[model samples]
Each structure stands twice: as C-alpha cells, then as structure tokens.
Target: MKFKTLNKNSGKDKLHSNDVIADFLHEHLEEFGDPKEDILKALNYVFDRGGFILLGLENKEIVGAVVINDTGMSGYIPEHILVYIAVHHNQRGKGAGKKLMEGALKLCTGDVALHVEDNNPAKFLYEKVGFTNPYLEMRWKRKQ
Candidate 1:
C-alpha cells in the first residue's frame, strides 16, 4: 500500500481528492462514522489548524484513510488527535487500517490521542498501537 498525506501545503493535484477521502470514511466507518459534512469539516480543519490527512492507497484505489489534527499543545494534553480512521469494508483484517494508523502516528512530533467506542473492535488495534485509556472522558454540550 502507498501512503500519502495532505496538509496545508499540499498542492491542488493530490493523488486523491477530498471528496474521495470523505466518502471513503463515511462509507467504511459504518456505525461509528460521522456525517460526510463533519468529515469534510475535519478535513478542512487540518489545513486551518496544522495537521495532515493520510490516505492509504493500493491498486490506485483508496483502501484506508486517517485524519489527524494537531492540538497545538503538549504536556497537559496530547499534541495530536486522530479524528477519523477507516479501512474499506472489504479491506478489513488485512492490516490496511494498522498501516494507516502507524503512518499517521509517525507523522506526529508528540503524543497522539483517539476516541473509540467501547464496543468498536478497532479499540484493540488502538491498544496494540500503544494507546492506553488513562481517563474517562466527560463532556458538557451546549444546548441549542
């Protein structure tokens, strides 16, 4: 598989288009996925806040993709948050996701963090990649 990263400085003629990347995530992520708009927003956020979107390609098709955003801080928080990662449904259990994650992690200068639903099998892969759950996440959403 070939890996390509798209960031703020990436040119217009990237190997894969943002639409392809967003569609791939929305499709492969299944029940754990967010809407395409949110994915697109995250993809755009990388360019605004300094991060990269990594794409895993094989046979000229996108087999997996990972979106990571630099949190712009360290010590008290991880320096990067892996926002999304997904491998094509037919490509699961074939190490494409792992390779994508590994490649994404390699691009980071400090600690990386990601959220996984408790029942999501991908949690195992995250743990295998050296991510530990050290705290329970609590959030307060503003009422609309």
Candidate 2:
C-alpha cells in the first residue's frame, strides 16, 4: 500500500508501459469492446503532457493510476482536468483507487475535472471518492 511518484529511471516507471496499460484497458473493455487506437493515443498524450501518478507496491507492480492535465481554458477560477483513472480489476475493492486519487488531488493546484459515463459502475466509486457530476460530453469515432 505504499505510494511513490514514478521516477523516469525507477523500476516503478517500468510498470507504466503501454503493454501493461493496454492490457488493463483490454480486460475492462471486454464489455465495451476493443477501444479505438485514439484511446491509447490519448493515454500516451496524457502520460506525456499531464504527468502520471501511479499507485502500487514498492517493488514496482502497479495497482492503479491517474492522469491529469491543465485545461488551458481560464475564466472563473481553479482549473484542471483528471484525464484518466484506472484501478486494475484485481485491486478494485481495495483502497488502491482512492489512494491514487488522493495522491492526484494532493498534487493538484486547483479544481480538477473528469468525465464519467452514466453507465460506468465506477461512477459510484468516483462519487464515493468525492467526484461530482458536472456535465455530459459525447465522442464520435468512425470504425476502423
């Protein structure tokens, strides 16, 4: 249940690779079908642009992860977007997800935002972790 910032050269970062991330996504996508390449692309973009935070063992096995970005749109006040959050199926009921989120929130300088589909069961967990429903957005991607 230890938490650490994934250093570039650290063994922890090795667990954050595309293959592992994709595998976790694939396991979840069985009900959602294969996700588009763009999804992985977006994940890579977030990893690069948002600075990823991972939750796992001190030895390098990742149990959960969260990606966040600074939304440039400015007006009222605090701002940031929680681009993605995922807890490995094996680690779901445990506090890995919440610990990862708390780590993300601690690093955030302002209010954060994220989208969750109405049908996602994780929505309940999100709410339990203090996220609120703000609005709805849709995605339209043509089949490859």
Candidate 3:
C-alpha cells in the first residue's frame, strides 16, 4: 500500500475517493446522519477549515484514510487535530492505518491530538506510535 497526502483541493475534487473515505468513517464511527449530503458537507467542512487528508491506497483504491485539521491562526504554532481515520474493514490487519498516521506526523509541526474509543483497535496503533496520553473527544449534540 502507498500512503499519500491529499491537500484541500484534491480532497474536495476527487469525489469517488472522498466517498470511500467518508463512507468508511461513517460506517465505523456513525457520527453523521444517514444521508449522502451530510458526508459531503463534512468533507467540505474539512476542506474549508484548512484540513488535509492522508490516504492509504492499494491499486488506486482507498484502503485507509486520515484527516488532520489544524486549529488556531495560520502561519504560527497551531494544534493539529486528527479528525477522523478509518481503514476498510477488510484491510484492518495491515499497516495502512499506521502509515497514514505516520504520514500525518510528517506533515504536522508538533504533537498531534486525537481521540479514539477505548475499545477501538486503532487505539493500540496510536499508543504504539507514542500517543499515550488521555484526551477527551467532545462534540455538541444537536437536540432533536
């Protein structure tokens, strides 16, 4: 597998690749509503926020994906946050996820912050890569 970075432009332009990454994340995390448009909006938000995507590809297929978003003003010290990561269920045992994270680390200036479920296997990969601190991942729940 090859890991590559998709800048904001390519991430937004490549619809098929975007869907593969977005759908994987949606199925694994279940963070968004069951609507196609919602996924598009989320990807657009990532692009608008100056985030970049790291993708693990095999035979031109997206096998693993990671999204990194930087917070704070541009051109200075910013906190890079790992927004979402997903490896195709069939591709879990491979090192695609690790390669994606490593790629993100190479792109960031300092330590990156990300949160994963206690039971998620990817947590082990994060710890293996030295992200061994506790962090809270919080989000606003829109009242229905």
Candidate 4:
C-alpha cells in the first residue's frame, strides 16, 4: 500500500469519485448516511482553508482517504482535526487506514484531534496511532 497527500484543490473531487469512499458510505448508509451535500461542503471548507487530504492507495486504486484541518490556534500550537475518513469495506483490516492516519500526522505540527462515534470501530485505529481521548466539551444543535 502507498500513502499520498493529494492537492487540496483536487482532493475533494478525487475522494467523491473514489470507488472505496462512495461504496463504503453507500453500503453503510445506516451508520453513515448519504450526506453528499454535507460531505461536499465539508471538503470545500477544508480545501478553502489550506487544509490537508491524504489518500491511501494500492495498485493505483484508492483504498482510504482522510481530511484534516490545520487550524493555527497559536504559536507552537496548531490544531489538527481529522474531519472525515473512510476505507473501503473490502480493504478494511489491511492497515490502509493506519497509513492514511500516519500520513496526516506527519503534516500536523501540534495537537491533533478527531471525533469518533461511541460505536465507531475506527476509534481503535485512532488510539493505535497515538491519539488519546481528551476531556473536552462538545455541543450540537440542529439547524432551524
């Protein structure tokens, strides 16, 4: 497997067309519904702000992708957040996700953060990559 960071301007399009990302999200819509508009918006926001997108490929085919943001929080402290990640179901358990995460970490200069649902198996992967759960507050409100 090979890991590569894609150009921010083109990453979103590549991800949207990737068989792995589209198929996995479609197959698991019960868990990650087909929120195409939302996903596109998130991708655009990341790219617009000089964020990073990493891709994991094998045989030139995309197996996984991760979107990260480098929010310059302060001198010596940039907040890196993994906004989205997906690995092909067929390619799961094959270390593709780990490679993608590692690639993202290489670009982060400070604290890194990501949100995983309580039931998301990917949490284990994050932990394995040296990310620890931090005590923090999060609140959500549905748009009116």
lDDT of each: 0.88, 0.63, 0.70, 0.68
Q: lDDT tens digits, residues 13-51, model 2?
A: 554666666566556444542464644664565445544
Candidate 3 — worst ten consecutive residues by lDDT sum?
A: 28-37
* Per-residue lDDT of 94 in model 3: 73
Candidate 1 per-residue C-alpha lDDT over 22-115 given as tens digits, one digit per residue, 9 for 90 to 100: 8889999999999999998998888877889888888879988999998999999989999999998888998888898889999999999888
Task: Give the C-alpha lDDT of model 1.
Answer: 0.88
- Sorted on lDDT, best first, the list reads 1, 3, 4, 2
Error of 4 at 15 (Å): 9.6
TM-score of each: 0.95, 0.69, 0.74, 0.76
lDDT of 3 by residue, 1-144 (tens): 877777666645454466766776677554422355565555666678766777777887777777787675444433777777777778777776777778878888655777676777778989888887654556999999
The TM-score measured for candidate 1 stands at: 0.95
lDDT of 2: 0.63
Top candidate (TM-score): 1
TM-score of 2: 0.69
Task: List where candidate 1 sits over 4 angstroms from the true fold.
Answer: 12-15
**lDDT winner between candidates 3 and 4:** 3
Per-residue alpha-carbon lDDT of candidate 4 for residues 109-132, written as tens digits (9 for 90 to 100): 677766778688888988899977
Where is model 1 poorest over a 10-residue stretch in terms of lDDT?
11-20
| lDDT, model 3 | 0.70
Q: After superposition, how far is residue 2 of candidate 1 from its true place, in Å?
A: 0.8
Question: Which residue runs of candidate 3 sit more than 4 Å off their true CA positions?
Answer: 9-11, 15-17, 28-42, 73-78, 134-144
